[model samples]
Target: MLMYCEDPSSFCSLVLNITSATGNFIGNQLDLLYLGWVASLLYPAILVFIILPSLILVLLYISAFLLYIYMRRKKVYNVLNETLHRDPWASGRYLISLLWDAHGYIWHGYEVRGLENLPDEGPCLIIYYHGAIPIDIYYLVARTILTKGRLIHCVGDRFLEKVPGWKVILEAFHITPGTITSCVQTLSENNILSISPGGVREAQFSDHNYQLMWGNRTGFAKVAIESKSPVVPLFTENLREAFRTVSWPQRLWIALYEKLRFPIAPIYGGFPVKLRAHLGEPIYHREGETVEELAQRIRASLNSLIQRKQKLPGNILRALLARFYEPTKNE
Candidate 1:
């Protein structure tokens, strides 16, 4: 090898070139290895964050639709036909029961306290804080049907009527208009009625502070007074964390809702967060109480329930962790 070199400097240059090539080759391989490691992590992250949640929601709705078809085929009771024989299993209560067992218990592990406050019989008014999706309220409704064999009438927002194909379902659930007349009639008929005074506005705009957006809506209180129904205050812990609406541009959404009464905000989060529903002591309307006075009392009771049970500025991670461990009330 030494005899073959015509120029010593040239030979030295060749040796240095070979060394540099070897070093570069090793560095390239190391970079490839690091990139592969990152790919492995990113794939699972995509699955967890994007794919799995969508799949879960799709499966939930599909199963519910299938169950509804099965129930309909059985002809236990016709949803539109008032003359049909009353069958509990054929009713909306049965559907809610199935949903409770499948989603509430297994996935969210939802629980309710002060269920005893719900009267065994008679007309009662339940006013609950509406969450972003109000899925917890669905769980509560399901639980009530499962335990009490009684249906809780709901006064839905006027917008629900505008949704195509929801008419039959709404009728089956006994969801009447949020009018004072409809609410009073529901209570006078000795039905346990549930109403959310904040309605769509609260669901769309309320933040972690859990502020009640009731704001001078005394219709529910007036209905209670007219029907002589005991008003029960209800709040669910960590409701804001489980499903949240887009916070930015909240003012625009609020204004649109106030004027047009449309729900236009984007909502996210379907985490398996622990949910607990608490019902405060039922407040009866006093003989001399005006509508404003009754409404204020109800609002205060609901706020008290939220303060006593929920941790302020709810954290999504903590809400998810609550699935594994118990949640403590904020001091």
Candidate 2:
């Protein structure tokens, strides 16, 4: 023990021990600082990407549930015997109306021009370009309920039946399985029905080109002819900007969807963009018009509407900024 004072080498050894301890302490402090820095980056990312979206989704579900309960308790969803066909599931209809109204107002500020073109009464066929998610359809339906007190029965993808727990909601919304017969019947009964001739293919692969994928698909035209309902060509401005499929490897997804009848494209974006649906004057089927001819005429009419209303290669930023500004006279 006396070597501490007597032996120089022993004193050097003690100093070395102190230096080693100091180095380890500093290294540990640096490691902690590094960990803190990493955590600082990770936490916000978790909050934004994971927590916030999940919370928002949960909030929506909760809100829907509460609204449903309130409607049920108030007997607001019941169908009166006389108006059963006109306003089925009054409570559900009302709840959905509120939800879509809030969504259209807050998220997109959606509006329908030429709504006057939609008859106040009688059968009509509304054929619109299908967006990646077709959210605009809901807005149109809700707007119809609010403006005309009429329900716009929709022809939905057949795969909608495969979605678990969606059947009831689909029925409530009068979303019929996509079939020529059902469409014809809906229109024959003097109901307003909407369908997309392009359906999932156009929604998946059309990109921002505003092209119709209704190749040789004249069933809707036949429905219009058989039901004797005037076809209303509808197109929404900035519809492509609201949602889009992933661009990379899109052809592969389209191929898969074609074979399996499944929407395989990864859809993204629900930007708070401006969405306006323009309805052209209703086109009636001429006596000599073939189904193919009728379909082509409607397709061309819709394309012209698109060319007039939407810019090619739609810009998401421009659409988003449109929420704050009014449309121009030319637009």
Candidate 3:
């Protein structure tokens, strides 16, 4: 089956907001949860991605909104005039994950493969290619948790750790500092941890070839080895098409961002592009492998996954025009 985006109408057009609000019509499906349960999930995404003008506040607002709705409609929360209330990390993270899943299915046509490879129970290290926005990580966690019933301790960049909004969400997800200590701790505790070895560099520099800038980043492997965790290589296809990085002066842009904290390289595109995440079999600890050697093993696995699922997410106009012109040429 073929799928591609179409030009918007001259007047009205399909947009993400309209697509998000489409949930209001699915009240019946939500009703199965009852108002409290449903509110717990929907309110967080709405408040976070919509209202707070930020992300972390989403955790608290989700609870408050759900409570208010439950009390008014179902009568609940009995708590006071609350400015803020922190929730269990799991609760907030679960809500955000659910939103990503819904959005992935309804908007991006997201798909995941190879779940049988994950360990039945134990700390596992998951490494993947990074995208400009990294929403694909959310998609992965959302689906993995639902299918595998496990929460992954994802790692984030130093820059995102500073974004006040992302700071909260990242912390709630057990992603912090991107340091060896945190990574080792996550895996040592027998919890799955996910990190993108390519990190911000790849996120900013990716191109048509799906380049991964994880050069010399072997610390993740060292940590995994120290924790005796198996490494799972994963890659989500079509990230480059989802958000194309700006070319020319790319290095200069990254330099300025590092020195001045201004966002650079100016990438765009969050369209409903198709996404396929490939999860590879675990690379268990090797007795004598160095950190670099172990990292290379994971990298090779990830590259294999990327190569297998990679596609251009072709231009809609180009595909249509070529099709229309095909028969004429043959004739």
lDDT of model number 1:
0.83
Question: Cα miss at 296, model 3 (Å)?
Answer: 1.5
Residue 90 Cα positional deviation in candidate 1, in Å, after optimal superposition: 4.1
Q: What is candidate 1's TM-score against the reference?
A: 0.75
Candidate 3's TM-score = 0.67
- Quote the positional error of residue 95 for candidate 3 in Å: 2.4
Model 1 lDDT tens row, 217-265:
8889999999999999999988998899998887888787778978989
- Model 2 CA lDDT for position 284: 98
Candidate 3 Cα deviation (angstroms), residue 202 = 0.7
How many clashing pairs per prediction, in order?
0, 2, 3
Candidate number achieving the greatest TM-score relative to the actual structure: 2
Give the alpha-carbon lDDT of every model.
Answer: 0.83, 0.84, 0.71
Q: In candidate 2, what are the lDDT values of residues 86-153, reduced to their tens digit?
A: 45576567667767866786678888899998888889999999998898888888778765778899
Best by lDDT: 2
Lowest summed lDDT across 10 adjacent residues in model 2 is found at 73-82
Q: Which run of 10 residues does model 3 get worst, by summed lDDT? A: 74-83
